[model samples]
Target: MNQVFHRFVEGIVRETDSNQEEREDLYEELLSHLECSFKDYQKQGYSNEEAMRTVMTNFGDERKIGQQLQQAMYPYRREMMLGLSVASLLYAYGVYLSQLLIMGDAHILWLVVAVLSSTALLLLTVRPVSSLNRRLWMNSLLLIHILIFFYGLLLATDVYHPVSIGLTIIASLILLLAIVLVYRTTIYDFSSNRQRSAKDAKRLHFINITTGIFVVFVILFFLWAFLFFSAEMSPAVFIIFIPLVIWIVSYASQMHLLSRQKKKWAYSIAIIQTAIIICLIGLWLLGV
Candidate 1:
């Protein structure tokens, strides 16, 4: 009966005129509701076959039910489509931006990698076989991106010399983009969203502060290193220092925030990172 029920839901999904995500959500909700109803029927002494029959009867005409569900999902379908369109536009613009910003004959490679990354993201969005499959796809997409980012950074450092106008523009754009992305991500905590006390709120605030500081540090350190080695100290180093300022500002802000929130544990972590940064800087200054 369970197998038959799955087949039934899959059939409904096939007949539905909604997007993949909506269809999947509809299938899961319907399956869960049927399971609950089936259990209730069993509790009332109905046999498995009898319960299955009752569930199907209560479910009404599967075709009509699917149509209704599809109709109800129209608004969500539009929103999903809109979001997809936005991503597509962003991907397209980002690729072209790279070509214009990055000097050399590497734009061809950039275009190829960008297309592949965008395609992977698109397929991951629509393909719905299993959670494991989806997770693998997501991981692969992230890996592709990380590799591409590193490759680009390498090109910027080694290939693109005389780091002047184009490099400055690229660094500024990247910094702007990084700051925005980090700000958006740090605004929300993705881990363990359970309810919490005032301390938890403080911890979350502390985490965001640390994250912002780290993000700035990473971006600036790379940019600084690149500019320092390339011997182009115009606006690149200046732009990098903006994030440096943010590092100081973020720490001071965090210190005040943690004190207010009474999350003293964050202080230890902050001190540890500060010590490491100071040590690394001292060693670097000493030509280590």
Candidate 2:
């Protein structure tokens, strides 16, 4: 294919969210059609450059066509983003109300998290799907926020206010729905004709980042316990740090694997690490 046709396909493919493999397939298919059309135009006695122009003109505007193709592939994308944005904002308000009513203090960190998440979701509604490098950031933030809410619920005392409890429950439910939306979009991304290694690499990277964030939060919690609650560094404390150490090591291994382009091994490590985390969280919830 000529440079004109190749560049045209490239333009369309850039507006798509398809992975490398799928993009190549699309490029080939579009190039074939353009070539066939050019030959037909040649039979009509048009010069080479004139034939190229005719083919391109008949194909329509590359950007507009690309955008349309994107919409066809992911029809409800804007709606879902908008819904999640509204839900996140509501969840943020609930968090603010609950903290004020229960702790009698502003939980600035969590409030910022909710608001930022909401803002990000809102912006995503306007942004093209292909514009974002990775969707991991939004999903990671939501997952962490959900866990924080769950932990708060677990640590609740009998002295909790009814209004606060009500707000927390409602907020948690809204956030859970938001999570469902996240899962749906993620599944959509994975369903595309992407390479397995490529998809796994993205997930592994997400695990690496999320686990590091969890480690920081755990350390801060421990520091707060020691300073404010007069807690000692007992065996129990060390026990809590055990999994964290393991997670840190796993993070290092994952980074090494990724650097080596051993994506499959990195993915395996990510799954095991995630399983361990889920098990630990289950035990904590069960009060074991």
Candidate 3:
């Protein structure tokens, strides 16, 4: 009987990403409910196994419990996606008009906006898939973002180096194709599974912090290169790389924390990241 109770409680906990307190509360409630069911079963002269079966049956489906918990915890993601979609369309239109008014090529500006919009859409849409699909989409997006970063780098070097923009354009197109594929993949994987465990969430957060740090280092390294080795670099490099670095770092930290288990390390990483971003922005503003 004790073993039976333990198994049932473990099932509930496994099905939801409830915190320890919430799990404890649910366990107590389930125990009380099961105790009552057991007493009722004994009164009806059922055997111990039959009583346990009856108790388990009345506890209802673990999957349903998981679904309800997910809905309760993440009710805002869908709404957020909708808002971002609308905003992206509006921003794209505005950029189009600005390009027409400027009466010159605005490919780089439009591309940057497209990258931003696509990233937002991916975050809102691509998450919450089966493990296999999730990993695939994540890897594809990682490649796409890397390519976009390099595309900007190429554009910045074009004026000084005058290399063919053909390869850069081709890479950008391929990145767009990848984004489209991932977007289509997301539409089919909307059903919720069990939420990520707290520990998994924490590890993901750590990854984000590490990625953000890497971006900052990259940006600083390039800035130093441009200042000290002006003969080998162009000022345009800073313009494109700075924003790319900042955007990547910011979102990496944010989503990483969102997916992780809450912990002291999570909070500490967040504080440090915020401080770094603030300091960088301040220095940039002061033109230092």
RMSD of each: 10.6, 6.1, 12.1
Tens digit of per-residue lDDT, candidate 3, span 170-203: 4344434444433423322232234455444444
lDDT of each residue in 1-288, candidate 2, tens digit only: 498788898889777655555667878888899999999999999999899989999999999888787677668765666776676677566656666776786557756766776776676556546545435555555555555544443333222676666665665565466556556545555354544455655566566656655564565456445545665555555665676678778977986887687877877888888887778678877984
Regarding TM-score, does 2 or 3 come out ahead?
2
Name model 2 segments beyond 4 Å from true. Answer: 1-7, 47-50, 97-104, 129-132, 135-166, 181-188, 191-288
Top lDDT model: 2
Q: What is the lDDT of residue 167 in candidate 2?
A: 60
Q: Write the per-residue lDDT of candidate 1 for residues 175-221, one digit (tens) a residue.
A: 34433333332332122223234345545555554554455446645
Task: State in Å the error of residue 259, model 1.
Answer: 24
Q: List the residue pairs that clash in candidate 1.
A: none
What's the lDDT for all of these models?
0.54, 0.66, 0.53
